[model samples]
Target: MTAATQPLLPEGFRELEPYVVDWALPTRQERYDMRLSKDMTELGVFYDAIAPRAEAAIAHLDTLDLDALPEPELRLLRLLFSMILVSYAVNVFEQPSIPDAGAAFFDTLVEPAV
Candidate 1:
């Protein structure tokens, strides 16, 4: 099959495919930006969907070499990264942006190679 026709996520992760467009960001900044843009309800929906499958997803990713992940696996990794960001908002802050941290912006200058 052509790359264009390939699945967005690896097998067994098809359930998460629906979230790929919005949550599967490649960089920490992108995930952070997404977190900031969404509300608690939106973030909660994502959290609810992924949290249940996190252990299985991590196990699947662990079988692959991080530097050599194929397109679909890489996307799965990014989805996990996004879940991390959303978790903080859903569980801790209970809001999109940090509490009492108005107008203060923090940028993730560097992130580990995907």
Candidate 2:
């Protein structure tokens, strides 16, 4: 589809991501449990496997103090974190929606103040 006819993502996806990141600290376990898709779609039963893994990882993460984290651990964290992020970006934001956001942007911006 052309830029003018592309769809936009659900707004909640944008709002939820940072919140999810914040939860990565204290509610790490819960957030891990909630690591559904970008839109939190039910992608079969085994899709929830990442949560416990995150919890287990965090115990080790707490020991490192973020400064002395080894490259491999960091890489794994990045990979897991990105998976969470991309779930939102691709599945939520990039999912099909009503086209015309570009038009809407221009329409809202170009219109005379009312």
Candidate 3:
């Protein structure tokens, strides 16, 4: 099957496929950049979609080997990671960015392998 015809997320996570294009980023910096680019409304939308399914998603992912997750599972994992980044904005900051911080950015030099 062609890339477009292939599934972007695991079977159980088909509902989240809509978000994959925007939120299922592979790296910390990419996710962080995404978080910074959106407003509270957008971030909240993503948070609400994933929060309820967090436990189930984790359970599903735990069944797989982390070092060798299939592409769809890896995308799901990335979506989970994006959810984590969005939580801070939706729950804590109540905004898309850190308050009182000016032009600060994360220079992520290291990230765990997926």
Best candidate according to lDDT: 1
Instruction: Specify the poorest-scoring 10-residue window by lDDT in model 1.
Output: 105-114
What's the TM-score of each model vs. the native? Answer: 0.93, 0.35, 0.93
lDDT of 1 by residue, 26-94 (tens): 889988988988888889999999999999999999999998999899999999999998998999988
Predicted candidate 3 versus true structure: per-residue lDDT over 1-114, tens digit per residue: 997799988887898898999988878889988998998889989999998988999999999999999989988888999999999999998988888889876688988876
List ranges where model 1 is wrong by over 4 Å.
2-4
Better of 2 and 3 by TM-score: 3
Could you give the candidate ranking by TM-score, starting with the highest? 1, 3, 2
lDDT of each: 0.90, 0.39, 0.89
Taking the tens digit of each residue's C-alpha lDDT, what string does model 2 give over 1-114? 696643221221222233333233322333334443324343211224444355655565676656655544554354346356334534455542223456332122231221
